[model samples]
Target chain A: MSVTSASPSHDRPHWLALDRLGVLITLILLSSFLLPFALFRANRILLGDGLPLLASMQPVAASVLLLALAFGVGAALLRLPALIKLAAGFGVLTILFIAMGLSAETLMPADNNYARVSPAAGFWVLVFGLALLVTDALTRLRLGPWTRIGILLGVCGAFWALLWSGLWNELSILKEYANRAPAFWNEARTHLLLAFGSVAIAAIVGIPLGILCYRVRPVRAALLNILNIVQTIPSIALFGLLIAPLAWVAANVPGAKASGISGIGVAPAVVALFAYSLLPIVSNTVVGLLGVSAPAVDAARGMGMTWLQRLVQVELPLAFPVILTGIRIVLVQNIGLTTIAALIGGGGFGVFVFQGIGQTAMDLVLLGAVPTVVLAFAAAVVLDAFVELTSRGGRRA
Target chain B: MKPGLLLRVFALALLIVLLVAPQAFRDFFALFVRPTQPPIYTQGNLLDITLSHLMIVAIAIGLSTMVAVSLAILVTRPFGAEFLPLSRAIANVGQTFPPVAVLALAVPMLGFGTAPTLVALFLYGLLPIFENTLTGLTTLPEDVMEASRGVGMTGWQRLTQVELPLALPIILAGIRLSTVIALATATIGSTVAARTLGEVIIAGLTTGNTAFVLQGGLIVGVLAVLIYDSLSALEKWLARRTGRLTRADA
Candidate 1:
């Protein structure tokens, strides 16, 4: 599936235009804060005073121009591969500012004031629109990495801007994302801290647990069955189960909250994410350990090594990669599932999503989703790198 | 081999205690609380959650298999390869957009019920189905088709009789994956105003009642794993029946 494998070099020669994508990303990022200013002024100029500015705020002309610019950017990103991505990015961001300028002037009165034209909101809507369209065209056109990066950044920037400003604060829709924001970080801190702690705990618990399962048949069967059962429960339920007992301890025990026995906020989220992590780590570790050849383990014993010594020296080293692979899957899945904690008052990006739904603001929803997606993907990529490193070490061993 | 039996038994005991403990909290609620007519716990409603999940899984798998097989067959012809990358990219984009987002985006277009649920389920199920179909079909022995043609079978006949039969085991694996994913994904249906197991869990979150959520979540999770395991066993059985067990070593 490698693109450069079969196609003629000349056909994909335009893949070189990717450098401009960086410029596009930078401009879009910088302009997100500036664009709102443009809208504020446009309304002031069109409705308040200034005939000259009102002419500039003309919506019909701007609408036509924005549509033309979007198509032009689409074509540039699609056709040129790397060539016009940066240029197109700037144009797209500029078109967004101009479009907003026209819309605000045409739609709103002069009294409303907000600072800096939001380049970021444009990133989500028009920017992602172009990116999604281009994602299809990129393959047909055989564009390479650079051009795609521009589109990614532009989309990300927009989502970030809207989210930061709480743009989707509307009550009727996208409300789910907004309601949870006040406790958002406390929820994030609870879960994020738990995720950090749980992964560490999982490696401790899951690896040894996996080894136990590998060494003992009945034990492995029992644990695997339990882990499998736990894994199947949707993440929401997992957090719910973890929360009840912890809440009991908080209320009943006289000084439990002060002593940190309260179950509600972060603890349950951690436990849920942790339980979710257990199956993969344990199963993988067990598989990896059992996968070590019997002859090799016997050979280590034959060299006058005791059981523990053999495990430390030969078996464990050989089993590390498979175990690591399990950990990788567990961590990645955990991050993705953790987003739902917002529902449980455990809060992460789920707040924004739920808030957006309640508030009816699509932009705020994207703010949560974009980061969660990036977080999940980043976790996956980082895990892959670790797996690659450990796997390489495993190979050498 | 059974070293952890006692530990596991103890752990299960703890799980039972933890799972059932919320009832004690409910009893406490009755002791010192204002009288509200809403029941704190109900067993029959949990059963309803299970039935709804079954329906979602059934519809999702049925529709997805049809679409996936059709797309898979379409891609086999010479012209299909040109669209293979495109199809896969579409599947990727579809998956990359969270199921929750799919639920959100689909609601306006499809209205607020089972229709949106099915769309989300179908789109969510597509990647696994398509990938498996592609893998199964492409991996078939090239000579199988030649021999069918050598015997003068038409292209359609070759596909249905020879190619598909040969590809059944791998294709079934994809079906298995789709089923598990669909089963779990049905939980999201609750948020979209569709009645499913997720309603139980979401209600638990909103009302701070862990028992209701646990009831639904536990059942849904167990069902998915069991179905996956059952299909896995069936896949192996099919492989043996088809002489793949013996042929694999060779």
Candidate 2:
């Protein structure tokens, strides 16, 4: 963990040599094999009857061994610290992966086809990979022309991988013991996608309102108040509330269904998530717009610009940072709430939460909630980078 | 009075348009509030929306103002300059955290009640208030602060007598923010099964009943706009009053 720190310790403890590029190579090699197995189960496997991860766990186990051996040999032959670090990292990560694969957990107590290997193996692999990646990225960090942007991108990439790939993968993971893990993973993935979609929708609607409110007091007050009320509504209830309008539309509308063929997935999920994101966008937009300053406005107006022109040309550019901050909040919030969307068949991570609650399966709960938490954190970090980038852009302008 | 009344009318018109527009969703509207069912938007529902809206607004604004004011006090002192930006950023982050996350995290400890919703509302309302409080407090004439200190006023004395009076206008703006945020967030109480205005809106949305959704959403929107406009008016009034008082006292 210290290896990933921005300011590394001078006397780098050999145990946590973060800059050990050699370790990254090894870690990746071990992960390449293990992850394929897990990913295969997620994307390719058909969970019909009793099925182990493979007819024999021979491939992953063998690949892990081979990966570890290759890294160690490559490290010594080259006499390069980077190579050595990669080799060692790979060996350790592979051992971890193989050990986890061997101890795969049962996904469902009652079902047969719904079982698979434990997903924790992939999660740890991702973590190991990320640790190496972050460390390497940090070592290469330097002040230059695109330094801030580079740093921001690196941070965002790490965050995206952690959220979108790691914790998120756990929710819809592949299993060796059975397909239950994959089943659970699918439900979570659906939720994540929908939740992300919901946030996306919110951004579409809220950001504009936010910007509008900044320049127009009457409008801003109205929007802020509406969003404020929306913000106070609890998650479960919001989803519940969203049902009414959508149901009404679905049932009454001539040809339109609520979500699509499913008539449930996107419509209700998007509405609930959208309602939740309103405040962040509206609040942020108003603040960001206001931050554009009176003089900037005066100057623009003095330049004989129209109100619309001043807003688009001056206010929006200045207000971009604050707006990004809001968007970041909206994104993070949507990630968490998307979990609750499953209750309505909107599908996503909430399937695990609700299903686990019903079956009293803590493993299923972990399968669902863990990914959401990670995704939320990852989302937050990425949003922050975007916010900073926008802010810097604003400053430069 | 005339313009306020006119705005109120316009707001009501907007509400009616939204609510009645969902006659388009007639079939979906029945799930929550059946045609045979007693009207959900009776005096009780409106009153309910109003009451919940007020309670949340009160709590959020009350708590946020306290926090912002106290923090403003601490950070506006002689040695507190460097901490100002940092404190503001932390406040911003607090506001940035989704109210849903706050509610989710609060659920375990608070166990699905107004308590969690209240806490969420308060935290979510923190940023604007905190920033405005700092802006209002700090932007006062430097001479005023120095004059109070020069004339042998203690820190507390100067704060209560001079600084706070000057900052009150800006602080009111923060309070306005808290009120607006709290009003909307109170709707989230439905997640915990806390029967509030959100109950109506959520009920409407879940079943695809646009009327119920429209009805509930309309009520919320109207209530929010009215209350916020009032707070804003109050802020303007306070700013003017303090402006006069500051000049007269000078």
Candidate 3:
């Protein structure tokens, strides 16, 4: 198929192309048409009955979505330019988001506080499919790093505007948010604190340890083995294991309790996260430093630069990108681990997740889960760009 | 005789003792629990919970391997080459989504218990296997591939006999990674009411039973390390067998 496509065949019919994008678009259409678009519940916690696309919203809104779907299918099948294909993908997505909100508004009985509406399987599948299409188009276009970040910001801003405009107020997740807005922000803060605070501390401790490991062969092997073993422990188990020791400290150790040190909360959570974080940072540092070119180091030595000077001015600078990559990994991993921190009363997004699970409130769970995902995804992208930029700059230097 | 084999045997022995006879370790665990509280997790047998946990990980890893390996193969093939970028993007992005969050999200659609947990583990495990398999298959030596073709091997024959065998070590590394991850993640399945070793940890957490938590954590940690080591050894062996690893590599 690629051979055929690569061949000089401009005269070939466009519809016969049937590229991979077409297959995804077809799946999007099939799912949107066949599966439930929205689910309507009597209350926040009850299981909702599925609603088809047409039945999910007003006729006009449904038709508008259908039109966008048709356009998406057209974009997929036709030999459109990459930019146009991208626009069609985004157009479908934007319409889908709006229609989801509209569906919730339509499905909810006016003045019925108990009524709840949420996006069902079909809605998620569409979002996923369209997102893939948009991504594929972007890849084909070969957008630069900054432009990709700008697009990310744009998409984020669009979602923010949608949220701010009260478009999705009737959606179950939004409704869950409205009730616990303050708590939501509070948990978000704690979540960020757990994830970022640990990474910050780990970097401070890990870099030097990594340097030491790089310098000392026996220590390198022993330290890495220990960290590897630590890494294998499940986050929950680690969190659980920390409880007793920290509690002991809080109780028996002077000023520990007063200093906010405890077994089950932020202290243990941060400690566990920090422990989990060290392996990546330390290993990355070692790798990055080792990766510094031998010629460069010899040149630095020839120039009469001291050992520390060579490390700071030569090796560290060269290794900065790989180190940043490690930091990126740790940051993302910590963010996810922070969710599990909620189990131990560390107070993060997982608070809502566990509470929702306990109460059987799916939307409440989403309130916790969605932001965690979005945050991890954003961090990954931003840090990936940083890594790429630095590596490129390193090459030039 | 080898250190890797010795470590594996030790871990396996310890794991079996812990699972089959909690009474043997009761005194040790009692140090952690208060005098009034039970040291052992008495709600379910340790062996049963461990078995179920292994079952969940096995099932999830098995399903994910099939799906991810197939997808990797598809995208690498000539007919499905167009999907390479898209599949890569999906795998990369999917991994950034946390396992715990994925498990929670699965609950809304699949409801409580093993089903949601299975779905979450399956999704969570896909990236490592897919990415590794993709790397392995694509990075095979060009000469070897040409040689296979030179021998008049059909596409299917080349893939099955030549490509897969040469790529087995790297692919095994991916599955090993996926399996290790699934083991850890499956413990979280208890939060969604799935039967797994997390039950012990959760029970301990809720009831303030440090012994139970330690018991669960110890078992999980031990199991993870053992499996990781064993798989790594297998990967190395495969690499050696395939001549991918020379004496210098060893």
> TM-score per candidate, in order?
0.69, 0.56, 0.96
- Cα lDDT for residue B6, candidate 1: 59
Each candidate's DockQ: 0.30, 0.11, 0.82
Q: Ranking by TM-score, best first?
A: 3, 1, 2
lDDT of 3 by residue, B182-211 (tens): 998898999999999999999999999989
Candidate 2's TM-score reads 0.56
Q: Per-residue lDDT of A307-397 in model 1, one digit per residue for the tens?
A: 8898889988898888888877776666666667777676676766677556545445555665566765555545655666677777776
lDDT scores of the candidates, listed in order: 0.63, 0.59, 0.89
Consecutive 10-residue window with the lowest summed lDDT within model 1 chain A = A43-52
Q: Which ten residues in a row have the lowest lDDT in candidate 3 chain B?
A: B241-250
TM-score value, chain A, candidate 3: 0.95
RMSD in Å for model 2: 11.9
In candidate 3, the residue pairs with backbone N, CA or C atoms under 3 Å apart (3 or more residues apart, or in different chains) clash, namely none
What is the C-alpha lDDT profile of model 2 across A1-397, one tens digit per residue?
1133223234445424332334444566456445333322322223222233343245666467455546443542232333234435444544544433443332232344344333433444444453453333333332232444454466556545544533323223333213465666677667667767766777788777776776578987777766766665445555555665666678778766623623355676777777778887778777777667788889999999998898789888887778777777677767766766675677776666555434534344455665676667656656666676677777777
Better of 1 and 2 by TM-score: 1
